[model samples]
Target: MLVLWEIYPWRNVEVKKSVLVVLVVALTLIFPLNVFASVQIQRPVYVEGKRIAFDISPIVEKGTTLVQIRPLYEALGLTLSFDPKTREVKGGNDKYEVVLTLGSDLAKVNGKEHKLELAPRTIKGHTMVPLRFVAESVGNSVYVNTDTKRIFIGVFMTYLKDKYFDMSWGLSKEEVSKINKNDHNELLYENNKFLFYDTEFSLASKKNMVPANKIYSFEGNKLSGAIVKFNSSDDFDEQYSTYTQVIYDLNNLYRTSSIYPYDKYWIEGDSIERAYREVYKDDRMKMYEMAVRSGDLVFICPFDFADTELALFLQNKGTFSKPEYEVSIMYEQNKEFFNQISN
Candidate 1:
């Protein structure tokens, strides 16, 4: 039967077609391995300061901002009730009625007029009030603890701004916490403004955030604040890409742990890159001066300032000059290296 079938030319063609179909399917199942090799992992946002460094990843909760609501009458040992039909909240035996209108940044407390920065709303069938102003009106306090990941509400007196404590450099967590708990009541200031940062978030990895506080708040000539952390996800590769996303949302630089510990770069193997045309400053002193004049924070890798990258690039372009002797000599060497590497 097989020999007879082979005699039919159509049979040979049909058998070959079946074999080709099986091979194609088999290869299709196995061919994705090499194509997936270039896949990358997203980088994580890192918060770094003079005294603190930590990677902000594996976030328990992820949001740019957080808001919490507090009930006033209930905390004061008084009865409270809300009427969904009327959009009214009643407190205590006095029947003090507080009316909150949805979609408007205003409220009426005890039949008198009141206002809010954000409006009240009904969530999960319960009337929710604006957090900040409402709580203040009713004599309660709310605090956001970034380290413990909690929103605290009680008869709290210490405002987040009042906890103007500094994280000292190179101190252990225990030392920093002790200071925070102390009644020192010191007002840390910089650039003629009161410094503000989340202490709990700062002290999460390290027991103490004094150094970080100091760096973040107490700049000699320039001031810096906690803009945001940068990270990549399983969805993307490259730290800069993650940073771009963060900047879009927060409009600030993403802090990282990448430290340029040394000021020198080896000329032999390092890739030569040109200076950014729109540099904010010419040299470290100039950077300091510019920062003072502008009061802006400047980002620097150790090599950009320490090595001859800036000087060499500047000399080749002849756009600016620096006063440092090492810069001029190194620029000469760097210029020679750049020419040699290109050829």
Candidate 2:
């Protein structure tokens, strides 16, 4: 899991003392301190399709579900600390901080005091907090299904976003053909090594009055790469700038670094010529490659380097002219795929 250090702004408000006392009394009577042993097993909590096993199971009090603090917080890559003297639990990263005191409706997030719907409390030696409040506070969307008695947290992906269109990933070729029936250009090629989808997609370019034709590639039922050919009339500098901006936006979104001078290499050619190859990678060995040649910019990453090397050979042929460059933003799917392959 990536550690999100982005600080989320939270508001602070004062709770009426009388209202706090009445709420505490009602909760105490419903969920007595000694009743932890008798409490039945509750519905499980899932984060992004994975079940979370808590040391002490989640419980309900006054219609609000409460879950153990350490397990859930740590699972989200946040550090948690507890102070027995003050009964305060402080957790979060440098970007945001959460401070909750036992049996107190008031909590401090980033040093700003805010009112919690239900005060955090200890149950059977484990600290429990309001499930919805804590989960949503850390940038996760929470959904409760009363019919199934289950809680699901995080975004579920339905389609993969590409430069021109949102394509369906993890779906078989036949499944895609059903929905993309109008796209007569859709072609499939397969061998013992892998399956491929060659579909023509078009997007507006600066020099072309009409949208230029681009072919998007799918391997193993996933949108893996794309080949964008640019018209000779297009300005080279403008195309480079456009590609650079796309790289910048991808870096910002994925929190990954763009290919820098230190990571760049040039082939034996004119000194004024730009490096034809660039690679973007994180510490985890996940890679994305961009190659500019002839009039085309070919992109392939998480695919073998041999594929990228073949692209370099094709670029050397100069059959293509100024290539339209666009980065494939598949950070989430790529991360998931890389982990599955590595493990």
Instruction: Give TM per candidate.
Output: 0.24, 0.39
**Model 1 misplaced stretches (Cα beyond 4 Å):** 1-73, 76-78, 83-85, 92-97, 157-343
Model 2: lDDT of residue 214: 35
CA lDDT, candidate 2, residue 287: 22
User: On residues 260-301, what C-alpha lDDT tens digit does candidate 2 reach at each position?
Assistant: 311222233334133332233232111212334443233222
lDDT per prediction? 0.28, 0.46
Q: Quote model 1's TM-score.
A: 0.24
Best by lDDT: 2
TM-score of 2: 0.39
Residue-by-residue lDDT tens digits, candidate 1, 133-244: 5544555444432222223334422211212223322233333334545342232432332232222222222344322122122122222121111111222122222223
